[model samples]
Target: MKKILTLSLLFIGLHTYAQKAKLELNLQKDSTYLLSVAADMDIDQLLNGAHQLVKTTVTGTTAHKVTAIKDTLYEMEVTYKKLGMHIQMGDKEMGFSSEAGADDLMSKVIKIMINKPFIITMSKRGQIVEVKNIDSLFSGMAKEFPQVGELQLTQIMAQMKQSFGEKSIKGNLQETFVIFPKAPVSVTGMWTTLTTMDAAAISVKTLTKYTLDAITDKYYQVSGAAVITPDKVPAFKQSNGYFMRLTQATGNYTAKLKIDKTTGWVTESHITKNISATMQAKKTATGPVELSYPMKIAMKFTGSDK
Candidate 1:
């Protein structure tokens, strides 16, 4: 009788531990939320002595409110709340605070970005549909820098968009949404998502495999591993009026996510990216020079809804 009772309790425990839950977006329309991301980059290059080290940290915060909803789609208005950065290279270090004025280039860019409104549309499944209100962003920048020529403005706009506009926004949101499965998932369940991204004029494809690591009363722990490979080699213009081609490239990433159970929102995420690439720079005078770059980047995100 004692043995039977022990076996029965063990069976009940196993059964309870195997329960599954459906992860779905529970964000309500006309609600407000706070989103923030902090990124750190460490760059090493073979330059003078040993290796040159460059460290940079960037943190940004934005407030978002759902303005409209149509069917399963949601339109959100976002306002920038904070933008701050810190950089250190050898003996030189720099910092930028939100109170800086438009006198300097970096300050001017930040000035243009503050309080500006952007619209993002996404589906109930957490897929980003589109990003809008970019033209207004540029228009405000133009007002600040009236002397910049049209061609120069265009180049600046391209770089800005790549760093902070549609692509960056979508990529960040993708990191959160890719882990969600359409159906209910049990512990140890696995899923996959494929993403294509541009890196230094090369199109790279990443295949990420995710696993449901654990499920608690409050949070779901998920883990992801990715393999990145170059799709094709592309030629790009160099800063010194020369041409360069990407020769070889490969990378990998690992991420851990802690998601809120009731809302399906990611409360915390930590991701690390490792990349190795070789580039051939054609010099007008000296034939060509091959350079190898190995880089690492780390990113973190935290958010809350109110």
Candidate 2:
């Protein structure tokens, strides 16, 4: 009887040890890292209650490099390496690719954007602090698409500036920042945050909750769930005698992040998001019509240190 009791206690202790663990982030200055991100997006348009009509799918891959310029600041560079898109409407289908001999207009545009570089500054906590070279990049694009008039160019620049401006950057920073507790977190530990973004095309407010799920010698696994709602929707830009107005928008996201225990860097992460929106549109022939669009976006990121 004594031997059996001792064995039972040992078993309970081993199980408890295996079930829970603590995790904390460890970061250092002057570190350079590279992250490869791949994204897949699907959008479907519904009109008159029809479930399927027009749909688009896009897949892209990009590399982001970050070098610590200061103890709490980093310079980030992003380069798109591959992009592919497919569009479907009834029996008609179209495709675009950033590959040789793809004559589609979107293909050409994708090619132009693929190799071009975008640089931004970010905080150590993953907030985008500043987006550099807005005017120069758009000027270069204006040269490529000369048919775009000054008014349209101005509107486009306005949109871009609104998205990358200081206020917007702070909002983005909040959304992207991973909030860790001041003390080490055990498997049962959890944290939550709320953020509002003033997006040019559509504003968003999100509430997210994160939990520490597991920990190993190499990395810590964190899981997050968020509810996203549209706070504001800008008047849609008109093009080719067609205009659109957003009516409603709502979404949710689930994310998984694997952080290196030693470096406190996110070594791998994946996020899945679903959004649904209704819009009113007016075309030259089709008067005013209401349409619903549902979109899904999935992204995966993997990182390595230099």
Candidate 3:
């Protein structure tokens, strides 16, 4: 009897260790989800022999409505319900919100963006394949700022595109959604994904390794670690006529996420990132000066089917 019980216990232990979960987006057609994200960033820089600190906070809410599912691709209409940003440098503060009136350029732009819907095509594995209708949205914004000169408008459009363009949107979405493993993942199962991000004039590549930590009746807990590497930098001329380029950059990123097992949507997530970088600044009258700084960012994200 003792030997038989030992064998039975061993079989149960093996079965428990072999349990797996398939993580995929399984939302029904016509379903809608609301997701909110908030991020705070702090930057400390040494410039001109002085230490300067800057703080910024950003918050946004988006609604995603599944419109169709064809084969393995899902089409969804995404709309920004709210967006806001606040920045602080020393004692001064500035901010804009979608709830505010169009009193300034930033507020006007926020007003134009609110409630505008764009379509995104995503795979079942949560990869964002394509984004559509963003150009049209920008065209509408241009019409609102008719008094601005064409050259200035072109520059404004270029800057806006860097944030709202299809590629940028795809990259942002993939950070949250493209985290599922292709196959069923057991506890302690690990997978890696590579992503590229555009920051100002620099391109950063990140390779993240994710591990399934635990599974419960309601959610799956996962953790990730990423190594960030900055690509070759191209010098960019600033509005003040000074040129700047990234000389070196290194960063670490980590995230903890709890995802709904039924819908494959993140119920809650926390992410922390730290980056140390050196920038070379040059001008016609001065030699290049290197400024080293460290930036820290903390972000929280949550999603709900309601």
Candidate 4:
């Protein structure tokens, strides 16, 4: 009888341990990638619990021979929470915080959304939780940023233009265009729109798709567009409502992104893995491009305690 009692107690203890909830997360969004760039940054917030979330500003300034000379900044109020394997965020509430790397007008007024890593974890009663390592999370999200070599925005632009020029479009204003060349025509800029309608229009189509044409040996016949029509969009709990429409390539593709719905800003988004052929040779001749394995962009999201 004593042995039976002991067994019963052990089982009860095991059950209790299993019942303790840690943190559950379903990344509502990583970020919305409206356009490709030398780098991506954004600011966002989501409300998971009654009083939880973190708000802050971010800035990233890099100069290369190819793209813009001006620096970039992101400022935002961010919120996050966990609920039974589901992590969420919104514009109203936030529970995590990160200090500014640099304090300035451009940095304070902007919120960075892409390449920011954050951890999410829940407490016993599931009332409190956390999101950390946002900068790293985003920075480390993709494993295949550059199969050949990482390039500065300026260099990326320079290569793009050298490969294909006049075919691409230019504007001090907002617009979209395509370039047909071997490599995608290179485009470089820090694009910010002036109005909601303009943002909506820009969000729907890719601005430019060709760069280093002779080197890449590919062309961007970009088509379609998706926009989030404004309509009192709710918080993260059920804020998935938005207008999206885009052209297809007669095949299947996976889409992922991080979004700040409060301001209709798309931080970063991408079709599953952007596959590209590669050449086994590291150093290559300055002329014809060698061939190699297609690049695979591996992305993962991690969660931790607040």
**Most accurate candidate by TM-score:** 3
lDDT of 1 by residue, 227-261 (tens): 98887665453433455544456778888887888
Backbone clash pairs for candidate 2 read none
Worst 10 residues of 4 by lDDT: 61-70
C-alpha RMSD of each candidate structure in angstroms: 3.9, 5.4, 3.6, 25.0
Q: In angstroms, how far off is 246's CA in candidate 3?
A: 4.0
TM-score of each: 0.80, 0.69, 0.84, 0.18
The candidate that wins on lDDT is: 3
**Against the hidden true structure, what lDDT does model 3 obtain?**
0.78
lDDT of 2 by residue, 13-72 (tens): 767555644343344444444444444555565545565545556555555566446666
User: Which portions of model 1 miss their true places by more than 4 Å?
Assistant: 47-50, 99-103, 146-156, 199-202, 232-247, 279-306
**What is the Å distance of residue 2 in model 2 from its true position?**
8.7
Candidate number with the higher lDDT (3 or 4)? 3
Q: Rank order by TM-score, top first?
A: 3, 1, 2, 4
lDDT for each residue of candidate 3 in 135-198, tens digit (9 for 90 to 100)? 7556576678989888877776666676677767877888888788888989999998887766
Tell how far residue 79 is off in model 1, in angstroms.
Answer: 2.9
Better of 1 and 3 by lDDT: 3
lDDT of candidate 4 over 1-306, digit per residue (tens): 999999999998666444321111112233311232221112121223233322222112211111111122111113211111112335552222223453332222122322332333321111112323433322321242344244443343333232112211121011211111222122221121111111211112222321111111121112222222222221111011222211111112233333222322223434321211111222223333232222221222221111
